[model samples]
Target chain A: MLARLARARTGGLAALVAVVALLPLALTNNYHYEVAIVVGLNAIVCVGLNLLIGYAGQISLGHAGFYGLGAYGSAILTVRYGWPPAAALVASTAGAAALAYLVGRPILKLRGHYLAMATLGMGIIISIVIATEDRVTGGPDGMAVAPFAVLGFTLAGERVWYWVIGAALALAVWLSLNLIDSPAGRALRALHGSEVAAQVAGVDPARYKVLAFVISAVFAAVAGSLTAYYAGFITPAKASFLHSIELVTMVVLGGLASTFGAVIGAAVLTTLPQVLTLLKDYEMMVFGAVLMLCMIYLPRGLVPTIADALARRRR
Target chain B: MSTFTLKHFTRAALAASLAFGAAAAMAQAPIKIGAFLSVTGPAAFLGDPEQKTLELYVERINAAGGVLGRKLQLVSYDSGGDAEKARTFAKRLIEQDAVDAIVGGSTTGETMAVVPLVEQAGVPFVSLAGAVVIIEPVKKWVFKTPHTDRMACEKIFVDMQARKISKIALISGSGGFDKSMRGQCLKVAPNYKIEVLADETYGGGDTDMTAQLTKIKNTAGVQAVLNAGFGQGPAIVTKNFRQIGLTVPLYQSHGVASKEFIKLAGPAAEGVRLPAAALLVAETLPDADPQKKVVVGYKRAYEERFKQDVSTFGGHAYDGLMLVVEAMKRAGTTDKAKVRDALEGIKGFMGTAGVVNMSPADHMGLDLTAFRMLEVKNGDWALVK
Candidate 1:
């Protein structure tokens, strides 16, 4: 059974790699590439977020705050202080991780809705600060981020960005999968199943919870930094409460505790809007309906429900 | 017999050549105008009408004989006020659609986000968003239709100077437009010999400004008050100003030039003044004014078609589409480079805003005269003159 589980993990990663590599064959234009890039970035964030919400069973409504911090941090560092894009991205991601570590300890102590509210408040505060600081972040008007470059080779065009985001996404998925199979991952699952029981079983719930929070925040931050550079602009809206809710929704919709499910959730939610653009004024109405139907029918989330069906069919 | 055969053959060849030439001319591809607007989000109020105006005019122009004998095609996407989405749509417009020009960016953030993309693509972009940053330093490929917050400040200051009111108090909201306008007013107050007595700001979601107003009211030698904001905040400020019974002149930025402001503020809005596009006062403008014909025509057509009150935001889009079309006409071809040159060389062209005089140095190409001063009277907008 353990060998089968290991095979399944490797199989999922290989399948994801194949999809990313083969997606370009079907993409005939830059628009397709652009949407794919956006999907990959969102998937990277959702992967990290899945580790916390899916594996550890921690709810965060302010993960977008970490994402926004990474975006604005890189934007300000590169645009204002003239730091190299690579250095700025690394520094911003580090900054967000440090912040998540500090806040995660106390915030993670609360259970259920209290934790959600705390994260929501943190996100709102970050959004307001970004909007208010017009001198630095350019406020709500947003500021341009310099093109992402490394070793004097600037990353330009949608095709180039597609490969960059694709590789990053694959790496993120690999890391999450590895983390899930480790002892720490088991401790997180134990905490999720029952915090009191987890403590009795010799797993430190507090440390593991904080660890999950910090890791998830690092994922969001790295994705956010990449987003700013890829789009060439950053706005306070990146950190808005609405965006946080959207990210959380992607994780839940993809199926909590399932790594591949998180990725599938990100892809569907990201591409749905682009497809619904054809509906024009009725786009929002239809989008809401689709989400409702999915929740009603596939309650276990998209991936888990389908996976369960396949197992039953084989039986 | 030989002479008859030669004559008949020459006539048939002439007819075939003529038909072929006409078919080639008729088959010319339409000029594609791309746009990305926040048509269904927080900024929908701005983008919805702008979208309507573009669709209305594009159809009208095609019916009245398309520019340079080719129909205009507008490919617009709803960005929903998301800057990242706006950038993505813009890329699609440029890279996939290969449009001749772009003419929409409903919010400053959206416009600013797409500026680099448009500039890099070398496509002419006429933004409908109101911000000095869109045009300041004059990006080569970018242009905007609405008057900047800085110009609005100058126009308001000029009106204050005319009234001999030098000491003014400013109460602004914390939104991007409010802050930018407040900053601009402070920057140019010295040029107009105006002194800012009190500068107060409220949060974006603040409902009550009574405390801020009372402080301004008690300030010594305050001749007028300017509220640099838009949305419900300005209307709330106007009501609060009246509730506090401050008799000083209340000036609002062009941000809230819509009739909704008057309706929201109720009877208290009666004496409030603002600088707005000529479209708002189309009926009140003198017949001799160059913009009177264009603004009145646009306002009537838009209202007749959409069955809604005409807005300056929509007028900005009208100006944007018309400018691009006019540039195409002047250039006499759909060549992107030539159309860009023609757009820059436009002078004395009457638009909803004013007489647009685009140049390499000034992409926006509207001066203080473009903004008309108006005050609320009998619960409607009245010409300030």
Candidate 2:
């Protein structure tokens, strides 16, 4: 039974890679491709966030600030300082990772709602700074981003970015899967199941918690930088407190600890509103209704709950 | 026989080339004007009317043979008054909707978020949002039809100085636009020789302005109060002043210039004054003003079509869409480059709101001189001396 489950997970991951690789052909339109690209970006962040929330059992309500930092880092470096986009992407992730590490050491000590509030405050402060510093981030108006360039070739159009992001996402998933199989991954899983038990079992609970926080922040930041280049515009809204909530919701709605679920969740939430535009006058109300229904009915999320039901029926 | 065949072939080729050129010109689509406003949130009061302006103007242009013989197609989106949502919708409009120009700004935050999108798309945008920074960064593509918060501050302070009101108080909401305006008001207060007696703030949607109002009303030598917000700002003028029994004259920011303010403020809005562009006076405009015909025509048309009274927000949209159409008409093509040049080079262009004369140096083309002092009389904005 365990071997079959492992095989099924691996098969799912492979199928995901194949679909992402061929997303452009399936979408067949620039608008559709753009939505798919956004889904990929969100998935990258969700996968990293999943490590902290799903596996390590931590919550971060301020992940969007790291994402914003990544976007602004790339934008300011390329547009203002004239640095290459690739270098800016690295700088942004490093910056977010370092900051998250510094802040998480203190804040991660608190559990549940206390940790959530601390992270939320960090995000609000970052958003306010970005918004008020109009001279640097162009104030609230935002700034243009230089297009993505890799090894002396300009990356333009939807299809090219689709392949690039797809490959990156696959690598990230593969790395995460390997991490889950490794010893440290087991420590994170142990902590998720029970922090007190993990500590009794010789895991340094605080150290692992902070490590996961920094890793998740880095992922969000890198995703943001890539998004900035793709959209050719970066705004402080990327770091807004609500954006962080949206990112977290994608992970929660997808089912925690499930890589495939994260990807599915991002794609659905990002594209759902575009399709829901037909609601017009009742768009937000309808959106709220859908969210309520999803929470009430699919509490364990789309993947795990459905799989568990199917297994039970078979038994 | 060979000579005759050559001549005929040459003539046929020339005719075909001319036909191709004509077809290409005809195939050029009508210039698309996208109207984005907060249709479903706090700024909905403003955006609802802004939509009407877009609708009525497009209908009028189509009725009058249209711009350059092509009807204007107005595409509207709801920004929801959220800055992030505004950014996303701006991208969708430019990239997916393929709009020729974009107009929005029911709030300072949303307008500012859209500036980069306009710059990246190189699409001309005129925001109704009143942040001065929306235009000051010299983004080539972004302009504003609404007066800036800085402009609003200057207008009020200048009026205060002219009236010899030395001590005043500033009460603002904590929302992004409110805070921005409050800062601008304080920044320029010193310049106008008016001392800020007190400065107070409350959170957005907080109905009890009593704390801020009490603080302001009790300040010694306070002769004026600049209410620095929209929507609830007028409610302060109505409720707080009478509750606290403070009878000093209240000067509202142009953000409060709307019939809805009068409706909400009830009898207290009777003599409250503010500085605004001409759309605020469209309903009560005198026949003698040269632009009265266009102004009144729009007011009636907008009301009939959208089933709502127009606000300055709608007026800005009206001017924004017209400005884009005027440029398109002058360029005789929807080619973005030519349209941009025509927009920047706009001269003596009469809009319902103001006479816009753009140059390479100034995108708005209208300044403090464009505003007139308007007073609320008989539940309508009357042009006051």
Candidate 3:
């Protein structure tokens, strides 16, 4: 562990993860903790998304549909249907996976801009359906989520969820790190590089691509389930196209293909609004400006660029 | 340096000076209310008037000594009707600028997005948005001055029964408020002897509502079509009716009371009846209704300030802020619980929305008395009854 910590890249990531895990300790207010927990949730979603967008060289401008479905599915099942939170989570994940599998087969076949539109339409349709089915989903009014309960222990308070989301984020990060270094991960990277080249290399691009989509979707589903349980309220906006854009922004801004970047991106984007609250009416303008600046200044995203800097200094 | 270089330098200096001037104006000390609106998006037409209303009301309040005896300041953020942006701006209002209260995001969707942020911080939130779910389940920290969709639907159906219009076609957006409106319409329709012939649905940003309207048009014995949503309400009133050649009387959801709806639907809006909170038709109201003196003044002030007509969207926002101020005065401090108590316990308070009579059980104090039947006469909302 000490040896791993001695390496610049690995050490930095470990320390960063520890800081994030310990964030609630420094945060006194529920609002701050809420923001921190949400950022962690977003980081979890972004991690899987990074693998798909960064490692697989694909675009999704509609992952929020999956996230929304997962959130509403978990909330409705657990709260309304009297299912266990864990069972609801499983249902949510399974449902999202099945939906992704069905949608991805046709949508993924459409390639490029067409795929983007197809995915976007799916997201829009989901949003519309959730909004319309008021008796079941609570429509635009948003549905209340069931609290996370395990073995008859109900999870309440910011402190509880701070830990819960923090732990989940940690496990998600570890899984991504391990997966990115695996043989399948290498094949994904090959596919990311060039579809034709990857096929020639016997990479089975279609299989890997579909697998990546499913995995990314599962990650989003888990995050959505966690969000519903934690926030205790879920709306159709969870699946909005703008939300999908935000998820992608978190991945790209964090450093796509970099495990630590996802977390970093989520943390920065989430907290930036909090800090820029002084802008009041001009907050959106400032947010837009910051995004533009980030795109222009750090094209590779924050984590990777920071890693590069630290590595350069060490050399 | 050449003449060209001097000209470039002069232009840059002018730009810098203008920037400095703007910065100076923005930094002025005042008791600020940070508002999140749905301007420049799908809800922009409704939101722009609200933006105008906030500015006008803030100006009115300031001219009238402002809230808490300090000049009430307003710094508005546009959410573009997006939930994430609404959440972001809500945080910005509370954590960053420390706004006394927040107002004006155009939909239930936008208001719901801001609920957690305000509730967590214990800030008094007054939404202009018409979603009952925003205040229902009683967060104790949030409130709205507008008549909810369910209440409006209930009111409309009651009127429909009075008019003996039993057979109705219902079309609604697949949103929370729309669903609520439709459900309430269906539930109370039977009570009022109104039968819903067809239940049609549409989603956000769908420009065409013809297919659903056509289905309703073909239905036998459909006396009136009740559109229980926004965005596409007036378009449905105009294009679909003319396209299907159905002249059955059309009733609308309160969401259609926006000025843009009148513009969007053209002359087809003339005979359409909708339950509106009194603020929309204030201008054409008879001089001595006497009860609407404040509303009339507000309409006049809003028009004078914005150089545009006032709509129900901003009217509710104006009423919400006024209610907050009244509560603050009654409570004598910005105590969240006191403000909440004062608001919940309010009685006989005349506002642009209506005579607001808040109670513990009823968060929204307005009712059918808050609205009279309003029609579009000469491209503006006029009191029909």
Candidate 4:
């Protein structure tokens, strides 16, 4: 059973890499690459979010706040203070992690809806600050971000960004899978199943919950920094409550506790709007209907439901 | 006999070649105009009409023997008021659609997000958003249709000077437009010899401005008050100004130039003044005014076609599309650089806003004369003169 689980993990990672590598074959233009890059960035954020919401059963409605902080942090550091892009990215990600650590310890004590509301408030506050502090963040008008550079080499264009995001996504998935397979991951799952029982079984719920929150925030922050750099502009909209909700929805729709499910969910939700442009004025209506039908038909989420069906068929 | 048959075959081949050449000439590729607008989100009020205007004019232009004898193709996307999505759509427009020019950015946020992309792509982008940042310092490839908040400040201050009202109170909202306009007004007040006696601001979602208004009312030597904001905030301010019975002339920024403002503020809006495009008071314009014919024609056509009230937002789109078309006509080719040059060299072109006179220094290409001073009378907009 151990060998089979190990093999499955390797197989999933190999398949994900293969898909990322092969996706360019289908992308005939830069637009397709741009969309794919966005999908990968969202996948990276969702994978980390899945660790908290899916594995530890902690709900956060303000994860976008962390993401926004990372974006604005990097943008401000590079554009205003003239810091190196790579250092700015690392600094921003670390800052986001530190903030998540401090806030998560106190807020993660609350479960379910209270936690959700707290996170939601946190995101709204961040968004408002970004909008109000126009002198620095350019307020709601947004500010231009300096191009991403490392060692005097600039990373420009959609094709180059596609590969960067693709690699980051693969790394994110690998790390998430490894964490889930480890003892800490078991403690998280145990706590999620029953916090009282997990505590009785010698699992420190508070420590693991904060650990998950900080890790997820790091993921969101890193993705956000890359997004700001990639787009060469940053806006408060990145940290809006709506964006946080979208990230959580991607996790739920992809399936809880499944790393690849999160990735698939990100891709679908990101690309759905672009594809739905054909519907013109009816695009929103159709998009809402499609999401509703998906939820109704696949209540366990897309990946989990499909995986379950495949297992039952083998039996 | 063999020579005669060969001559007939050669003649048929020549005829076929001539027909093919004629077909190729007739099917000249269209000039593609791309756009990304916030058509279905918070800024939908600005973008929806803009989209309608583009579609309406693109069709009309094609029917009227199109620019340079080639049909105009408008490829637009709904960005849903998300700046990130707007950037993505602008990328698709530049990289995939390969449009000759871009002509939409419905809000300042969306417009500013797209500025870098269009500049890098070296595409002429005429933004419909109202912000000084879009045109200030004059980005090589960027232009805008709407008057900036700074220009609105200047126009309002000029009107105040004409009325000999130097001492004024300023009340603004915390929203981006409100803040930017307030900042601009403060910066330029000295140039017009105006003194700001009182300054107050309310939150974006604030419904009551009675306290702010009362403070302004009690300020000594306050000749007029300028409220710099849009949406329901300005209307609420107007009503509160009346409720408090402040008799000073209430000046509003161009933000509330729409008829909806009057409807919302009710009778209190009757004496309120604002600087707006001539489009709002099209019917009241003198026949000799340069923009009168153009604004009236556009207003009538838009209203007749869409069955909706003509908005300055839609007029922005009309100006954007027409400017690009006019540039293409003058350039005599769809070449990007040449068309951009033609756009900058445009002078005395009558648009919905007014006579546009673009130059290397000014990408927006409109002056104080472009904004017409108007006041609400009998619950409708009237020319201030």
Q: What is the interface RMSD of each candidate, in Å?
A: 1.2, 4.1, 3.6, 1.2
Q: What is the DockQ of each candidate?
A: 0.61, 0.20, 0.25, 0.65
* lDDT of predicted model 3: 0.77
The regions of model 4 sitting more than 4 angstroms off are: A1-7, B1-27
lDDT score for residue B350 of model 3: 89
Write candidate 2's Cα lDDT for B1-385 as tens digits.
9999999999997876578447555554565787678887656877887876777778878899877767678777787776655766777778877887887767776776667667767888887876666667566887677767787788777777788898988778755567678878888888888898898877666877887788787788899887888667557646777778878878787777666688898877877778887766765666787667766777777777778666666777888888888788788877777888888989877666677778777777776656777777887777776
Model 2 clash tally, residue pairs: 3
C-alpha lDDT (0 to 100) for residue A288 of candidate 1: 95
- Cα shift from native, residue A159, model 1 (Å): 2.7
Q: All candidates' lDDT scores?
A: 0.90, 0.77, 0.77, 0.90
Rank by TM-score, descending?
A: 4, 1, 3, 2
Docking class of 1: medium
Residue-wise lDDT of candidate 3 within B1-385, one digit each (tens)?
Answer: 6999999999997876577436344334456677888876777876788887777777877898876666777878777776656765677678766776676667777787677767778887888777666767777777787787677877787777778788888888765556677777787777777778799888767778788888887899898888887666556546677767879888887767777787788877777788876676676678877557888888788777778777767777778778878887888755567877888888998888788888877777776778777777777777766
Per-residue CA lDDT of candidate 1, range A12-55, in tens? 88888989999999999888898899999999999999998988
lDDT of 2 by residue, A43-101 (tens): 89998888888887888899999999999888988888989888889988899999998
Give the TM-score comparing model 4 with the true structure, all chains together: 0.93
Report the TM-score for the A-chain of model 3: 0.93
> After superposition on all CA atoms, how large is the RMSD of candidate 4?
4.9
